[model samples]
Target chain A: MTKPLSPGATIGILGGGQLGRMLSVAASRLGLHVHIYEPAANPPASETADRITTAPYEDHDALTAFAKDCDVITYEFENIPTEALDLLEQHRPIRPCREALRISQDRLTEKGWLADLGLQVAPFADIKDAASLDTALERIGAPAILKTRRFGYDGKGQARINAPEDAADALASLNGAPAILEGFVSFTREISVIAARGLDGRVACFDPGENVHREGILRTTTVPATIPHSLATDAVLMASRILTALDYVGVMGVELFVTDTGLVVNEIAPRVHNSGHWTQNGCQIDQFEQHIRAVAGWPLGDGKRHSDVEMENLIGEDMDRLAQIAAEPGAALHLYGKAETRPGRKMGHVNRLR
Target chain B: MTKPLSPGATIGILGGGQLGRMLSVAASRLGLHVHIYEPAANPPASETADRITTAPYEDHDALTAFAKDCDVITYEFENIPTEALDLLEQHRPIRPCREALRISQDRLTEKGWLADLGLQVAPFADIKDAASLDTALERIGAPAILKTRRFGYDGKGQARINAPEDAADALASLNGAPAILEGFVSFTREISVIAARGLDGRVACFDPGENVHREGILRTTTVPATIPHSLATDAVLMASRILTALDYVGVMGVELFVTDTGLVVNEIAPRVHNSGHWTQNGCQIDQFEQHIRAVAGWPLGDGKRHSDVEMENLIGEDMDRLAQIAAEPGAALHLYGKAETRPGRKMGHVNRLR
Candidate 1:
């Protein structure tokens, strides 16, 4: 195992969105400084981070300089450009490794990797062109979802096909980008496990949280998920297996489908996830801090849930409810300092203890 | 009632020490920015604060610039120069108000104010010169403590008067500074209530934590103090009374001597106290966050402890035990990011949940 980072060491983060903002706060809590490298000026994380480089990822010199100052590099988003990662790795190590990103960035590759690990995943077929789309639709059948191969998030770059007649429009929705057709699985509910793997390959998983979504954006994640104990154990074990296989050394959020058969792997996020926000109030250590500890090569904290919690996202105009939320007892409100509140934009969240 | 500050507003903090560093982190958590003003270069708070002004309090231009950038000004230490406070109050509002500082800055004045508020405090006398010191010693009797009125902290500027033979030397040790002689009280244990008073005159108090001091410095603060339930209620009520009398607008740490008779007010810190560090892991809202909320004119959170916690201060060499402490299950380590660790300096603290 690599040596653990000292308290004063700097952790360089790639993206400076809400996840990076929360990660920076967590690093500061442990006496570590975070240097955020973001393209946009005055990013959300810039206010709290120790240093910020407002340069695009295309600027290798800036990336090199950022890496030179940091002991280790990690990221909040998974879609970092390959050239940028290549330049950053020359100066410092990146946690969760490039392989985890390689698999998670593509729907086909992620499903294939999970299937190769003997885990159940939705049936998927890669589509390169119109003919491939027809063949994939024929095999996957109707009521399937077609997603772009990369750079997709928060319901973007996705088109659902309800019947064979909708295949062409679904393929057109990709705009000639590579796509994957996934056969929809009949599931009772969606759940996620926020898990971590330490530098020593030690694994820890928080209790699964049941997820509820509106317009494809996550709305709430409640702990003590209705899943039975035996299934929870299986879910944790499956997540641990994925981490060990990738040699991952940071937190990952594994979204799963609870079907009549068993748990089905839906997707994996290489950094802290929205589904794990409740851990901030429900457990001793939160997912953001757990990710910081893992990337810093420190021992993983005990991921035991101490209380029942319900975390609700405050998207866009939902921030108008701040007055009511703040008035609620035992509710912890977290607001991202974004200047604009456009439609569908995540403004903040509230974690209420039960 | 004062208007609550918006999320993007800036909070100016004096004294860029650990308290300020933690306060900056708390402010950032609530989507607020902090501008730290300190004389020292690269003070601990600079690593977390949004902006840092490395100028002495004598730099009126720098102080004016800082106040211009902040919506409201608060402080981490009480020993700020009177001239600096006078200049700052002219530009922006200071939380806890100047009256609280005025009273707390002078030991004799603080004791008199407490006595006037119907709070029990140690018998004290103002000592202006050698003659007054002799007269105070005669009146207060032996085995009392002589302390400088303006700048004493952490047992500094203090001398013990065991008997009449030690009176002259003790008086000479003050270096001709104004002083206060306090009669010693035999007590069972030292306990402190961490309380907050919102802008609307509403108040909330966390449970009192028993404190243990070593060489006049706090070593440990354990919650669920061995005191009876009635005494705990008295401690909270007394702290609330003190806040009400001051018309305070932030968190205060009220230290008390728990005797067989009742609780005696020992001292009150106008800012977040070291004894309240346990709240970081014990409650939903911590002392730093509570202080920020109060100063921001937000509603006070439920200051309820959800878990039993023991916070041990990692002073100087105590940092060497971090490897063992980190390996301990459920121990949350919070380092202050101080570059140099000298004996008796507070480097960090650990909150262990039981």
Candidate 2:
């Protein structure tokens, strides 16, 4: 058996946003040091990490140094450039593996992978040019979402097409980037399952969390989601199946759309996700810590919730209510120490246990 | 109202152990930068801090630089020298105030302050030397404990005098350090009240936790501590009174011995204490966040427990049980990321909620 990483082992993290910041904290709590690799100066994770390499993702030399210093490498986001991953993988193991990244990075590839695994996903078709866009629009129709196959987040690089004429403009707006047209589904609510797969292939999943979004940004997630037990079971099973298929290690977030008939896979995050923030206050093992443990080659933690919980994101000016939220009984408030509170920026979050 | 500290404002942290580490995490969550001033390299807090100044406490130049960079200063321990406090006070605001540190550093002074505040304390006497030791022994009697006046923690720098003949040897062992002789109380249990005092004198105290000690090191603390509501109320009142008397800001821990008649003040830690670790899983706002809020000039958070909780320390080889603990239901494991786990070292802890 391969020996698991010890407390002093260094774990290299890619990306330096709030997710990376929380992951660094969790890794530090597990006696594993973190070295953050991000291009931005004063990235959130740098504040709590053992070291930071402020170099561009394409800097192979810096990536080589980061990989050399880390016992294992993990990314906080799925949109990591393939070349960066390829460079790091040559020197160190990357948890969740490149296959998981390849599948999750592209919308079309992700949907195709899920369909191949016998999982239901929204009807989708690739659009390469104006002609293909016309065909896709005819097939998928108006009111469908045309999204770039890669590097789309927080409602960026995606457009809603409401008319046949809007299709040409949407394609033009994307700057001729590769895109996918997805047929819209009438869903009752959105939910996500956060699960981890250990190096030993052990999979542990927390209960599904019902999600609410504002302008495509996650607003809140309530655990013990308002769904049938069988559906929740199916969601967890679906997440486990995906992880097993990819031979994944570390945490992965599986977003699902609750349809009238059943749950359909919406997307997959190859790293920790905002929807699982409730675990920080609601469950015994948070998604961050579970990811750290899994990447460190340790056994997965028990994903148990002691109380019903609701997590509300402190988006932009919503942070002004920190005092009021802090005063609420049984509310756990966590703020990302970002310097500026721009519009739609995720400043922090509060988790309330009921 | 005083304006809350801005995101770019630097927070000066004194002492650099795990408490400071956790406090840095909390502060960073709010976008505040941290500068750690510690005498040792590789301090736990240094791992995540924006900058670290490793110099002796009395080094004026280093201390001046640290104070100048910080908007406010707070400490993780009470053993800071008076000169260091004076130096920092001249440059920036120091939370918990200098009076709190003075009272807490010296056992004699702390007990005297408690008695002056009309708080219950064990019978005590000052022992200067061997001659005075005899007199103190006569007053406090056998089975009394002799502890140095300053710089003692985790049951160090202390010796028990069971008989008159043991007095001289105990006094000799101190090597002429100023000491206090206290009569041992037949206490049934030990508990600690962790409370935070805001700049405006607002006090928030968490539920008292019953602490279990192993070899004078805190092993476990269970919330909803098996105590009567009246006793718990008394503990909170005592903690509030101590904070108010000191005009304290930030979190303070009041260790108490539960007697048949009432509670007696055992010691006062003018910073976060291990007994408060349960807050990470049990309370709305943990001691670290409360401390950060107090120092940041923000309103104090509600210190309310959401669930019954138990915290167990991972000491030495006990860290090996981390995987087992992680797999246990309702267990939240926290490792300190320490490089070594020598005997008597606090490697990390785990919180279990019911």
Maximum-TM-score candidate: 1
Which lDDT tens digits does candidate 2 get at residues B306-338?
A: 789899999998977766776675677777767
| Cα lDDT, model 1, residue A143 | 91
DockQ metric, candidate 2: 0.66
DockQ of each: 0.69, 0.66
- The CAPRI category of model 2 is medium
Report, for every candidate in turn, its global Cα lDDT versus the true structure.
0.91, 0.88
Stretches of candidate 2 exceeding 4 Å from the true structure: B320-323
Q: Could you tell me the lDDT of residue B241 within candidate 2? A: 94
State the lDDT of candidate 1 residue by residue for B1-354, as single tens digits.
278888899999999999999999889878788999999998889988889999999999999999999999999999999999999989999998999899888888999999999888998999888788788888889899999998888888999999978878988998888889999988999999999999999999999999999999999999989999999999989999999988999999999999777888999889999999999889888999999999998888989889999999999999888888877758888888888889999999999887
TM-score of each: 0.98, 0.97
lDDT of 2 by residue, A1-354 (tens): 246887789999998899999999888887789999999998878888888999999888999999999999999988888888988999998987899999988999999999999999998999899898888888877789999999999899998999988887888889878999999988999999999999989899999999999898999999989998999999999999999999999999999999997989999999999999999887767899999989888877768777788999999999787667766756777878887888899998988886
Task: Give, for candidate 1 chain B, the lowest lDDT window spanning 10 residues.
Answer: B322-331
Positional deviation of residue B288's Cα in model 2 after best superposition, in angstroms = 0.9
Model 2, residue B250: distance off in Å is 1.6
